[model samples]
Target: MVVLNWNGADDTIRCLHSLDAAALETPFRVLVVDNGSSDGSVGRIRREHPDAEILELPSNLGYGGGNNAGFRRAEEMGADEVLFLNNDTVVDSGFALPLLTVLRGEGGAGAVVPKIFYMANPSLIWYAGGEVSLRSGLVRHVGLRRHDGPRFSRPGTTGYATGCCVGLRVGVVRALGGFDEAFGMYAEDVDLSLRLRAMGLRIVFVPSSMVWHRVSGAFEGRLLRKLWLRTASTVRLLQKHGTPFSVPLFLLLLPLRLVPAAAGMFFSRLRREESV
Candidate 1:
């Protein structure tokens, strides 16, 4: 398990405690990447789980940066695979083994993500990998809210998976160089997914592997903040893939992007029974 930590001392402690109890079929090491946290988290973990490995950075490298550091350590350890779990997550006891089982057989499956449930609301599905419609330029969940029936219960390839709790092959990640640090935070996963797809690799959703995540805890619950980062990252991603004519293409698509967000706001207010 590779976790990135800031000042989340309490959550970090809890995550580690859960990992200690999660019985695995194979031996797996836990590496905590401390992104220059001043909460004395390193000291706390050392005092608590002395056997666990810890990597400390000089400053906060954001999510992509922190995870990249952990990925490097995992690579150096010669690990066959690396699983990235959020500091605010509790991995299910059967998580790692099931993922490993699927990974060993699935060709083109460079990365695999488990079914994530809201730590606060375990019944709700946080994400189910879906199709990215190029025509609409929107991403949708294949089995978001419907249920965990035959549709969602099966493991298959997806356009992308949440970075919250993903298991990746070490070689694939090393070749790709972990998450794109240029993204800093938001949409780094999206950028990573696109790159993997470009390489003819697949990102899969494995339902048997599960984890409970505290949604948006690291970024806090700031809509504007999420929007700003997401929009900016999307722009950067498009820009990189977009050629010199990218400007004209973005111009053509800018309205398409705004319309949905605007409509979403209107419906959100309507659902709350607030006057527009």
Candidate 2:
């Protein structure tokens, strides 16, 4: 498991503890990569979980760089599959086995994501995989903010599996050159899954394997910043995959990509006005 930490010591520590206490029987090692944090996150993780390997980077590599570093190290260490998980998440009681089971059983599956819910309220979903419309540049989280239900109980193919808690077959990922670090952070998972799909591989969502995410724990309330980063990543996706019309498609879909965030801000303003 690779947990990327950027000045998020508390959440990283909690995530480490949760993984250490997981019910899965697989022998594994956690690699906590400190993306040039000044908050002493590396020291804390080392002191708290001496068993985990600490990779202290000299500068912030962003999410893609950090995880790719971990992935390369994991490959060298003979890891058949690598789990790229966020430091602000808690693995469900026995998360690994279910994910592995699906990845192995599904004939063409190259990766899988666990069902994710909000850490603040475990009953509410944060992600359950997502559906993306490349034509419209619209992506929507499956069951976003929705309560858990029977509707999400089965394993299924997803447009993309989130990076927050996803497992990938190392050999395949490495062959494809790992994740495109240009993504920096946002939308990297989507880009990876799209590549796998284009290559005729599957990305599965395993609901039985669950995780809870502290949504935006490390960078809360920075909507505008995240929006631009994600937008830039999506644009790159078009340039990389949308052949014959990449530039024009990017221009056409740019504003559509911001719709959800814009709608969110619009409603937030209305609520404040009503309360006033």
Candidate 3:
């Protein structure tokens, strides 16, 4: 597994610890990519987990580039599969085998993702499966905030899987050239999913496999910044893989997402001015 870190040393350390300590059915090694963290994350991670292989970047490479860097390394190392996990996640000990089994068994599956729950509220679901609409080409996360139950009992294929904890078929991904760096930090997973599907690969969601995440930990309080990145990435995705109406649909829906964020920014500025 490869965990990407950017200044979240504590979270990354904890994640490494989980992997080191988890009881997996098969042998595994971890590769940590310190995405140019200014917080001394590289030094700290080296000290904490001397066993993990470290890849130190000179500067931030966004999510796509950082993971691609790791993917390339994994490819060179002759890995059959690679898991891309966010540093903010604390994975379940037995999560690996089930996902790996599906990836190996399903010849058409390019990637598989585990069920995720919010770490703060363990019973609440973060992801189950995802859908990409054929008409609008819009992607939606299934069962985002719902509580865990038997309703989501079965495994299913999805159009996209969050990069938070995805197990990838390394050879196929490397041959396809991995993620498009044009996506940067957001929607890169969706772009990868689309490209894999174009190549006749399936994206699977395994309900039996689970991971806990501190949702969007890096951009937690920077809502507007995250919004803008997402907006830009969404447009890039549409342009790259648009149906006849995809661009038009995205354009029409853009403001519905952005206007609210702009209003929030406007009000925040107004409140500051009033205080002054």
Q: Please, what are the lDDT tens digits per residue for candidate 3 over residues 1-276?
A: 889999999999988777865645556778888888898998898899877799999999989889999998887788999999999999888888888899999468889999998776678787898887645646667876678888765787886989899998888887779878877778888888888888898899999998988776786457678777877777778778877788778778776757765664455344334543
Note each model's CA RMSD in angstroms.
4.6, 3.7, 5.0
The residue-by-residue lDDT of candidate 2 on 162-239, one tens digit each, is 989889888788877888888776888888888888889989898989898877765555667767777777777766
List per-prediction Cα lDDT, in the order shown.
0.76, 0.81, 0.82
Model 1 spans > 4 angstroms off: 134-136, 145-147, 242-276
For this target, which candidate reaches the highest lDDT against the unseen true structure?
3
lDDT for each residue of candidate 1 in 113-162, tens digit (9 for 90 to 100): 89876565566666767565333345555654333566667778888867
TM-score: model 2 vs. ground truth: 0.89
lDDT of 3: 0.82
Q: What is the TM-score of each candidate against the true structure?
A: 0.84, 0.89, 0.90
Ranking by TM-score: 3, 2, 1
Worst lDDT run of 10 residues, candidate 2, spans 267-276
**In candidate 1, how many Å is residue 48 off?**
3.2
Write the candidate numbers in order of decreasing lDDT.
3, 2, 1
Which should have the higher lDDT, number 2 or number 3? 3
